[model samples]
Target: MPAHRPRGAQRLHGTLPAARVAARATSPQAGGSGSATAGSGCVHSRRSIQVVAFRGERVAGRISSGDIEALRERADLASVIGDYTGLKRAGTRYKGLCPLHEERTPSFTVDPARGLWHCFGCGEGGDAYKFLEKVEALTFPEAVERLARLTGYELTYEDMSPGQRKALGRRTRLTDLVGEAARFFHQHLFTDDGSAARTYLKQRGLDREAAEHFQLGWAPDRWDGLVRHLTNAGFGQAELVDAGVATRGQRGLLDRFRGRLIFPIFDASGRDVLGFGGRVLPDRPPTTAPRDGEPPKYINSPESEIYVKSKVLYGLNWARAEAQRRDTVLVVEGYMDVIALHRADVRNAVATCGTALTAEHFRQLEKFARRVVLALDADDAGFAAADRARALAEEAGVREVAVLPLPPGEDPADLAASGAERVEEALADVRTAIEFQITHLLRTANTSTPEGQVEAYRRTFPLLARIGDRVLRYRYIRDIVAPVVKLSADRIEAELDAADQEPSSSTAVEVAAAPRPSEPRDPQLRLERQVLQLALQRPDLLPPSWSKVGEHDFTSPASRQLFVALAAAPSGGLDDVLEALPDEDTRRRVRALALADLPTSDSAHAAQVIDALRRAAIDREMAEVRARMDTQREQLSTDERRSLAARIEELRRRRDAIRDGHEGG
Candidate 1:
């Protein structure tokens, strides 16, 4: 028999269509209320499919308010996350498909041991219960009951729960510990002897304060020197390993940033300590026997729980606020350049990791300021990178991309050593991306004659296509090219117009060539990571889940869906819990607890959810009605039940008025 639904209930309950329901919702029985599980005594009697939970047993718990809370606690988030993602082994954590949305490169992460997750890709973070509630649309009690059922636990509630408070405290301590570790490593860079790190920087022109400000330090060329120091500081090697600062693979234990000048990498938010980048001092490569043991010219902080290079900037955390303050960001090629600018009081400066400039890097700089000045070394690699960066920034819709070209053989370090005036000049006379590319290519291809002029235009104008500014592009062609190519300003203008009008024979070739500057595989990952980042940053800007949207709905399909889910479910930062998705290789089908993005904690908010739920249900029903009317309207009276059909039509009328009357979107 169907559960008896009171006609005068506080909220209406009915299954409208498959679209509005969870993937696991069961079909309604004939002559039934279409509800599988009745709301428990403590729960509101508005549930549809009776959500059942199991712990590899025959119904260990039911989706009641009491059991739900327990499951919220004990839900093995790894299992729940495994369903959508195909995770791979990434040290201690299992990484896979970013459930927040579609990702080719997994920025979505999960720490099963801690039952915590965070998507560096999108800024979503939280514990297991919160993740499910947000991602899967489970109410707090519903999530709790589901988890309890999944884990066979009894969620007996209390008036004053300490879980949230305790968890907050733990996070503070962990963050502090990471900070202390960064400080310790930074301090070692100063005191370590025979290290010409200071001499080298002085030779190159960076002062002590600048070095220290950037946490520039030399790792004591010894294998376990850091390990011993960290141990004395009461931090376990395991923790070090987990943080991705050191490793203990087969060589027992070793420092990851040994004998190198360390540059710390922090997220754009400027809060979480992500990781580090290390550059070897000159003459200290493996060939030089400084203490007889040192590695290569460069080393990076291994990807740790807090660090994903794809989502971090070497100096943006320190730069973003200043950039936000000053309305500009100084982008340099190396860590020394970033430090030099900072030491010169130009706080809005950042550098790339060992990786080349990427779209992900641009995305971080995007939020801080409008103008982006690229400080490149006046060398081949630097010039090449400048060209690439210009093209990339233009493609990404950055308006003011400037090139800060240092004097030949002199870097920011040398410039800083020269004096503050030199740094000021470099900062002041920044070249726009178009002007820089045009001038750089003219110099590269030898613009001495008509052929040279044609070659220069061929090499440079393609980059101009990316420049969103037409007037500026024409001006660049007129002012810069007229002089370099000995062409008149009018001639240059006509050439630019003709160039814009016709399709270049090399369009496809250049498009293909531009993508593979260093790694062809990077953009897809960068794009996915950016989408995840936006979704995580503003989940509320989106709706609840992807199931509600069409497959091709979002501008960036994966990111939009994740954003919607995050927005739909703001579960105490459940976006973080999504990081715990299990690896596909592990055969982890799913954790029943993590069905939703984040669960609502307050049952009182259940009333609040009623509006969203009704909207979602209405959408589902409307879609079904449209589909049915399109396919089966001819036989509408033949197969359907009259009462149910009438209810559907009535619901549509009510929802349509609400949607059109400024009540619904």
Candidate 2:
């Protein structure tokens, strides 16, 4: 999650306030995911030594600023990192494909500084403290705490001793402090002062169970109340400021949110409180006047280390598993609506965080379910969002998009407040994408005028054409033309013909006549990939048995690099090499390739992949030879044909130079 910051304590979608002014790891201009500076090897932590410091990396008593760095240097970074990735070697270092997701090649890089190793793949660097925070998925403080326990040490204010490793910086402690502050807010919500927010929830139809399930909270009107409470809890203002919970003002540091209805935001795991969303108690329409240029309602936690607006969908962490189980995702427009739906037993409902859907969002949703039900407000903006979402999802290959229309002037919250049945009724009668678009077009058309009728056709055809699936296109076309264009069946048929006709006949001919050329490759590639995967699974396989002569002929740039990496990896296993892969996706791709090496159900699939690659190489070469022979026959006379035959025999002899005893194809 990219940390988002607000201009005047106001919030933006999918962003949390930024912290850690460390050297900007990568310039935004790099134009890709993963940021690593030149000359910086993959940073890492020594996992072999278990010490539970504050968050759980080193012993609290023994940890110093330098100690973390030392631990990283001393720890076998390659060994510890291999657990998450498949590794190989570059010239001087071990490399691996990243494990975060999938990739066909390695980007994870590692350095064997005494106690730590670093992963360039995910832009994570540091010692055991850092590794735990990055890979083991521990907060810095949690990693410190874990390490402290492991080393049987206690935390103190003593200055870090000289020569201690450079664990991650103190910023990690703030994540823990934010968790504490979230607990503080939840506690305050149950107090008498929280009566209004609690009442608001209850009146909106959220029962006690739903309230507690969402961990609803309240913030007092006073700016400094939260600050005071956190102070008494032993957290410093610096930590709170970093968490975006408090800030340093002209007079003094004070709470970031006050006098609002607080909703704690959780990570995708449904475990960590990454940020908060607060709906101003006296919520007003966006058009309302504000005393200090504030938005009329709905303020979110500022950009912090934990939130990125483009990524976070409010209520999704809790709804994903449910959505997966139901095989459908219900989307509403506001936070309270999600609460209402969940309370009403529709656990699969989620909402955007005060932002419209984007392509990034649709792709994320596709991971869990294909069915998307958009429950936008009945207003023009809501309808526009629905249209945009339908087009976006269709472009991304989603199978179904259903648009549910809310009652006029009623948002999801209002509909739910009126009655859950009305909400359910609307959702239950969800309109398929085409029908929904056509109905909207009809409603908007001015049928009284001839111009209006023509305008209707203009609006309708474009919508129909956007539906990519050919099967669905005609289904929608039938629905639209049935009432409007049906009077002239031949004309409608002619229109369909116009649409079906190629825009450029020459282009169409070129597409149709295109030959499917086989990829030029060698069987050695698959064998090398398999060998590297096995070596990654168990490094002991890397002694003297591996040979590079057979696999170097691979043509895919990425796979070839991986092969070369494994063949040269100095001391680490394939895990080290994979940990070196720069992104989670690349690592996962390598894993997908390596799944062939695993003793799992996909073993047959793996075999198929290897066989396919090797076979393609042979088939391609054979096809080339046949093509040459045909050309040879076309241009040669009788005497030339005999000479060509002699040349063919020589080519055959060269082809027969295979090491195996079997005859060449």
Candidate with the greatest TM-score versus the true structure? 2
lDDT of 1 by residue, 1-665 (tens): 11332332121111111111122111122332222222221222332223221100111112333333334445677877775466666898887666665467778888887667778777766666556554543434344433444454433322212553343234333444455656766677677463577888787666776665565666666777777776787776677777666677576777776666776665443334566777777766632223433444556776654455655667775665467657788866567667767777777778766555666667657656678887765544455566556546755666677788778766676776667887788777788765766677778876667898766665665555444455766677677766777767676556544643332232321221122222222222222332343234433444333234332333333334444544455362644435333344211222222332332333223222323334444644544444333223322333343554676788778665643444433
lDDT of 2 by residue, 552-596 (tens): 345455766666556656656657667666678777777776555
- TM-score of every candidate: 0.48, 0.50
Top lDDT hit = 2
lDDT score of residue 657 within candidate 1: 60
